[model samples]
Target chain A: MLKKETYINGFSSINPIKDSGNEEDVFRCVEPDYKTYIDTIAVRRLGKIQRMALVGAKMCLENAGVNLPDAIITGTGLGCLSDTEKFLGNMLDDESGLHSPTSFIQSTHNTISGQIAIMLKCYGYNNTYSHRGLSFERALEDASLLLLENTENVMIGAVDEIPDSTLKITQKVKTFYSKSHRNEPVAGEGVHYFLLSNAKQPNSILLKEFSSIEGKVSYEEILLECKRILLSAGIETREVDALILGTNPNIDELHYQQLQNELFLNSNVLQFKNLTGESFTASGFGVVLACKFLLGQTLDERMYLKKKHSKAQTVLIYNQFKGISHSFFLLQNV
Target chain B: MPSKVYVTGLGIISAMGVGVSETLRSFSTEKTFVRHPEILKTLLKEQYPLGEVRFSNEELKSLLKINSKQSFSRTSLLALIAAKEALFSSRQKESPLGIGVISGTSVGGMDKGEYLYDGYIRKNGKFNLHDAFVHDCGDSTNKIVSYLGTQAYSTTISTACSSAANAIMLGARLIKAGKLQRVIAGGTDALTRFTLSGFRSLMILSDEYCKPFDQNRKGLNLGEGAGYIVLESEEILNKENRKPICELTGYANTCDAFHQTASSPDGNGAWLAISQALALAGLNAEEISYVNTHGTATPNNDLSESMAMKRVFGEKMPPFSSTKSFTGHTLGAAGGIEAVFSALSIRDKIIFPNLHFQDKMEETGIQPTTDFKKEVEIKHVLSNSFGFGGNNSSLVFSAC
Candidate 1:
């Protein structure tokens, strides 16, 4: 079967960190201007999750110069955490009285996707995926499938928000950062959007191929799969200049180290999670970082794993959400 | 340029019944299942009606033979039950045909999440971290996959009410793309106070039976159920000499981008989706034998869908009906449930009645088939599912 080529024509993100377009600049911590983007009255009703998604989606479309996309596909690990917490809290607090419907309505997993479609007046294919870590990757896969089927101009993204109630709950369950580790790192909200097109554009990075895997595949096995992808793109592993690894200091260091040893034995290894705290769809932020790295931008100190490296020619992005949904993508500079 | 996708098996558990046979029997008998919420414990149980599956969580867990002390959300248990029945009906259990599972769900384990949230936050309350696992919508799909004992490919789609329809669309595309030979595609959603209150807040919940396309139609009654269908590629069907129930001829998904929770007044998105599906199927609107309208009975939905149908069919619209009167609005599961109903319509040569229609809407002259009809040769059936955020999908199923 003849394969249709797809390219990432544009990208944007708005997180706890700075917004997109300032690649060389990095902020250690972000104090977002929520009031500027959201109305005070609306802000009262808006949960942190909805606000983050709305702002990020707006920024993505503005960056992509797309008034409306053919489809809107989004992924989230925890959907509307703040609203979920609020609704559940209210339900348990008073079982009978009329509860505020805003939180409950927003708590559905597809709210973000629905909001994006509504905001854009994009009555196209709108879908959301919530698969723990693989959420964003699954959305990407669906976007790619649409492209392959001759659908054009899709907006695909991942958004995750940090809710105080959820944070407290996770802490109580010991699934979140402990008091001892709170100062070490803080969870942040982020939204990364990509304008994918079948037609390659100038200054665009060709999304050669993407593959999702589950379970623990040996390093050799992963390398084999990587080779097949690279081979299909008519490139050699030796020809690749840099490898961008989604290494979270908390959970992914060891796996990143072992995988790097096997795949990038000779190539330069670059890591970026230290600059951006771990989130379900943080791999998407990593993809943006890889794109910048491939565009000949200098790496920030917080994102570098090694010293200065040669200009990146071809870059490989390998991300796993929670050691389960492993994904690989090979990209080449135009 | 088009691909062939076959629906070999169908399974569903709704307020109407537990299996395909039961559901069909109810449909044929013109039995309406909308009633006051019984299985779910809620304050508005007596005030609002719901299309509930009439089984408590404990009863469902026992029936599924699951002994895990950890609670299974109403959604997961319903999904597992429906998916298992689908796999059993297909009889391709041990066959290595690269089977995949794609489910559409909106709330997922919110039922469990709602129960565990307070416990997790309050130190005095016992909290199981495992319960948080249900917070992810994909967890339910993952659980279904594990229960099936096959993992060629698995994913979940959540686009509000259109989720399952989109799941079915993706499953068909995967087979057409030769990514997998067979896939179990559907959606499951259970009634929760969260959704009920949410709809109530929207002022769209009906106290009596939902009357779609009626001038007096108040709003939709929320429903809880699961639906699944086994889709196989033509190559696999030919190799195994399997019988196909219906052919998933074409599908199209388009967003309305009209409002956060309401469809466009003109139904532009719905028109595009229907036109695209018809174009892909290489058929005209006149060729459709019947249409399963995404009639949620809401003042907005019925009007919008009716306008779109008139735009596509012009003066010659096919026989159409909204079965939501039977099962209510199943949310994410509505697409899957209605898809099964479409296949049944094709196989059984029947048109399920759209109950509780009193008067036609002033805006659109379209009235649904209000009584069950038999011996009708249904060659091609169009199923529409539009959801919150303007997500609109239309699927075309043809008799095998």
Candidate 2:
């Protein structure tokens, strides 16, 4: 292994919030002036997910002060659902095998990365992973490897959208459906992008480890993986100041709570999925929130689970989907 | 020094047939498998020819000994069939240093999802909600990993047609990073009404057999199948006491950054990928013995790829062919199956011909090999796979 230290130079996320005291703003992104990042003409043709990804990518690059990166990689678990729903509805209504290609084109999983590539004219390594919860982790893994292999700069993003139709289907499903708990984490959308570089910059956040375990992993398995990562980084479990847990009372909250209690006992554990909701790439939203917490920012009252810890140095963000797969990531202030 | 990744085993199932021998037989016998699909329940079946795997979903499950009680999508079944062959051919009994699986799929379990969603939307009948949730891209990877009875890090890549090549590239990267000693990396996709309609809407589907690099080429015939290659670190190959099929020496993925659905006229992405892969392998363009071009036979792709080839090789181009003319355009699995063909080229020293070719494009004037089978002294082979959104990837394979 090259064991090269990777750093996040810049980050941006266009995510949905649960409340705005208004109906239209309830489920939409309140961050990023889309018009500032996207042109007037092009903005009309792009969908919400597309526009969010473009704005997030541009903001990431601008924050890093780099015009173009060596690569643009992205992950989307529920890929362009609004456009896909439109296309599918058209197909269902008219089975003539003919329709406008615009919706169909935007519905592809690679459309986000490809759109970024087109916007930046970045003719470098580009890829998109759509493997459920592992989507963003795969993007992160690829970005890290690129840095390790001497690629100077890479942009990694993860985005998921819940169109009304798709959200209806998700709500009908048993896992995401929770009529009893109104404030529970549910289907929300987000687009998160980070600029990663091989060279460290001032105030850059060091990415220590990003790992995932899939398919019916036990509690011990999760603990062992966490131990391996911490051991490899020469950091003790007691040294971790804050832990980010993917806890949702509606679904899959107990697993994370158990993990926190078993492995990260007495740490200032935090909750992110509560605010980000249950999108497949909610891990991205969680990690971004962790980055915020690690940057010496005070916590929002809703975000802090236990009492806030003072003088934080390292944080761990762990998330899983329906308890079938688990992802563990460790980050340190640099 | 960076670690070396070796291709120890390969398995494939396509319109050509099942297993490696069947695919090789199609190559040797020059068989045409594109026809009206019996498996894909699409309304456009009569309007377009497809490269559908011969076996039906139930028959495939039976072949894999999967019980009827458990639901398996056509994509997962095809993936399992091909992956089992790959693991067997790898000849490793257990994972001593841990293993992983990285699969690529353009449409994972969409065939099943389309049916179930129709039931839910139309309220036609009771749909299995459980199956609906499993219709994700990662679901196919999880199913195949479980079938192999191993607990390894698994993920799915969905970069459209360049997906499998990207999967192979990631696998090689992991091995080089010492993340794992052995990995099964490939791609699988089944013919679905969603993709058939989507491609149909794109208006790129051909009504006839695809002809690569032909001046009168119409378009590509969409294909469905699975192809997997077991890539292990050199340490594993040495420990297992098995001969490697080939060495995965070079890979590069570059985006055209030109258009969403069309390749750039300059072929910037393809040229950069080819040049970079050659550079990474520490070889010159002239040293590539054979080239497996991503010749989907589409007018835009053939011209762009030909221009890229001309840019990379100039007048010193080696024998090259697009196997898609034989197996149709296998989308996500194209890279995996093409890599298999590239390794077979290095192992057998034979060049599979591009099936239909009468005239070359006027601008490039680069002609693909048209003979049925051309025996050659091959050592290294380069393969190309390009997808929509201008994603282009190239891989280089060499003899052990």
What is the TM-score (0 to 1) of candidate 1? Answer: 0.93
Candidate 1 residue lDDT tens string, B1-400? 4458999988899999899998988887796798998778888899988999988888888888988777577899999889888878887845533689999998898777776776667445786677777766887898887777776888888878998999999899888998888999999999987788778877898999999889999999899999999998888888888899999998998878776678889988899999999998889889999999999999999999999999999999899999999999999999999999999999999998889998989998887899999999999999999987677899999987
- Give the winner by DockQ: 2
lDDT of model 2 at residue B104? Answer: 92
lDDT of 2 by residue, B20-109 (tens): 898888888765688888878767778888998999988998899988576687888988988888888888867522668889988787
Model 2 residue A76 lDDT?
A: 84
Q: List the residue pairs that clash in candidate 1.
A: A123-B254, A123-B255, A123-B256, A124-B254, A124-B255, B256-B390
Give the TM-scores of the predictions, in the order they appear: 0.93, 0.95
Segments of candidate 2 deviating more than 4 angstroms = A18-28, A178-185, A236-238, A258-266, B93-97
**Model 1 clash number:** 6
Candidate 1 falls in which docking quality class?
medium
CAPRI grade of model 2: medium
Q: lDDT for each of the candidates?
A: 0.80, 0.83
lDDT tens digits, residues A1-334, model 1?
1267778878876654433433321122253466665454644566666666666666666666667778888888877777777777776777666776777777777778777666556667788887777888888888888898777888888787766666665555544455644422245457788888887767678787777786666766666777778888888776767778877655533556876676576677776665666677778887787777777776675666764357677888887654676778788788
Candidate 2 lDDT, A88-191, residue by residue in tens: 77776776658887888888789999998998889999999888877898888888889988999999997988777566556667546446444445766789
